[model samples]
Target: MAVTQVKVDATEARLAAIPAPDKGAAWIEAARDAARARLREMGLPGRRDEYWKFTRPDSLTAPEAPAAALFEMGEPQVFDGFDRVKLVFVDGVFDADSSDDPALAGVEIERLATAAQTDIHWARETYGILEARGQTPVPRPLAALNTACAGDGVLIRATARAEKPISLIYRHESKTSDAYLHHVIRVESGAELTLLENGPAAARFNKVMEVDIADGGRFNHVRAQGRDHERRAATHIFARLGAEAVFKSFTMTVNGQMTRNECVVEMAGDDAVAHVAGAAMGDGDFHDDDTVFVTHDAERCESRQVFKKVLRGGAVGVFQGKILVKAGAQKTDGYQISQSLLLDGDSQFLAKPELEIYADDVVCSHGSTTGAIDADTLYYLRSRGLPKAEATDLLVLSFLAEAVEEIEDDALRNEVTARLGAWLARRRG
Candidate 1:
């Protein structure tokens, strides 16, 4: 195949226009410099890039934020009943007046911007390191851009089991705010922490989160990307797991004009387990994409990718997931499934599932399916005297239950379910 070379003049100009990172600690400045160099070489992804072919990058790469009206939040917040340490950001800047103190018994938390102004910390080593490591095989220039320019986020280290979950809540009050944020999390050996995020941060957002799990550590992440009809965002999560570590992440997205979520996992130690799942719903000019990559480099590691999207009224959904098992990583177990339910004929779903294994004793499977609601099942629900809209919503919830079930915490799962239900109710009304 002949390779097509893209013109770099425009891309180079955009990279040059991005403001340099604010002066910080020496190590942070060094890291940003390295990331900026890498991003310049790789350039921003365009329509021709194989990985970004399904979704256009125009909205995401624009110099100014696409016009997005601030959405009035109506439904009860996710995890309303839970007692947790809250860190709040308004327009992508840390709001200390609205947020709790960054002090927890078992976990040490600091604002990345504040920490960079003080002495060196552990986050200096972790910030953007995994994103740098994930640059091979495929380049993630958006993540690299975030690493180079992000102005605010949090750094968390867990030394013991956390007494309560930590919540990062974002509020979008500006119509043209462009926000870039990066978060680094480290779960030490035998430590556990649950991280929760809920927000519509800005009109345009770029985010990167890097997590490092030591031996026997466990990390749970659950997020609900907020409902804003004109918002656009590109977010990436890079994680590396040590021996016997556990990593689980789940996300629910509703009503964004464009959202692209990329999750990359490297199982670098034996007996480690990782699972990532998402359930998204879109209606009328909405576009949502979930791209995930998992690599197994150690023996007896397990990984799974599950995603489901419901689209209606010309909405577009895309899923691209792959699992790779390296040579000599015997007994690797991998599973992946991406499915979509199109409520109307005009809606569309695109999926690409791949599995590449070099080990002989590995068990790997992947599948993708796109279809409308089951006619028979719809009929059964309608026969029970449910309205057509209610019946359809019921079926949608049933289709998403599999992905939602991956959330291990019962209360959090219920909260997510309620949020989904509320979204459906609003749509039906």
Candidate 2:
């Protein structure tokens, strides 16, 4: 097939206008600068780019580069009011006074920039190396842009075992402007870490986070993407798992103007297991897209993924999940399923589940289904004297119960459920 080219002057111009580089590790700074240069040469993603086809980048054209600011935040509330080690960032700058994580035992929690300055070895090796090995050429623009101007977030290291969970909150307080945030999370060996990532887009925030899980480790990552009506944001996450390592990630996209989430999980060792699941509820003119890629490169690896999307009004939802097993990745077991419910005639959903396997001794299966709410079930509920809106809400909850049930944390589960219920009320009203 012949390759055609399209001009990407806008993307190039936007990248070219970023401010001068600051003092940091010469290598990481250089790597970021190089990526920007490459992006300029490659241009922005277009319809030809399969990964970004459904969610175009044309609408993201900005008149000027985003500025740095100290955004005003709303009344602060604990993420479920948990007594866990916590770190807070408002508009990408760390708030030392706002954070109150009781200095836990057997954990090394420090500011990312502080760690980058004092203990450069650990920070550079974890963030710099993993990103290089996992980055792709297609979505290079986003990563490059983040690298060039990555604000301070958190860098936590769990020494042996953590008695309590380690939580981080990225809050967007400024509603009148756009803010950029970049975060890095790493877990060492023989350690257990639970991360509750809360992205409440008050005004607007564009964020990129990179996480790495070491050998003999377990990481549970939960993300809540709930924002006001005027907010627009995107999150790009890349994670690598070592031998006998486990990663379980759950994401709930309940509200937003435009939200895009992409996760790449690479299983590079034996006996590694990765479970990815998410639920999305969109209303009005919302655009929600969740894309995930799981690659198995070693023997005896397993992965499972399930995503459920509920669409109402003129909302558009997209789900694309792909699993790839390499030639030598024998005994790889992969399973994927995506289901969607279109509540109204004007609403739409697109689900694409794909599998590419080169190993003959592997077991892989994928399935996708798109349908309306079961009329018989709805009638049965209405027959029981329940209002139409209540019946629909019950059915929507029932449809998404499979994914919601996996959340082990009680506080997070209840909070997510409440958010979903609130969305259903607005839709059925």
**Candidate number achieving the greatest TM-score relative to the actual structure:** 1
lDDT of candidate 2 at residue 71, scale 0 to 100: 38
TM, every model: 0.97, 0.89
TM-score of 1: 0.97
**Per-residue lDDT tens digits of candidate 2, residues 1-429?**
222344366665555554433456655566566656655655655555777767765544353523323333344443556667777776566777777753878777776555545534466666534444555523545555655556455677766677777777766655335455566667778787787777553344556666777887888887877645545666677778888888888888876667777778889888888888898887887788888888899888889888898888888888888898988989999999888888899888877788989999999999888889899999999999999889989999888877776677787777677767766776566
- lDDT (CA) for every model shown? 0.90, 0.71
As a whole number from 0 to 100, the lDDT of residue 259 in candidate 2 is 74
The list of candidate 2 runs beyond 4 A from truth reads 1-8, 16-21, 61-78, 201-204, 426-429
Task: Report how far residue 242 has shifted in candidate 1, in Å.
Answer: 0.4
Predicted structure 1: lDDT: 0.90
Q: What's the lDDT for residue 355 in model 1?
A: 90
Please tell me which predicted candidate would have the highest lDDT against the true structure.
1
Model 2 poorest ten-residue lDDT run: 65-74
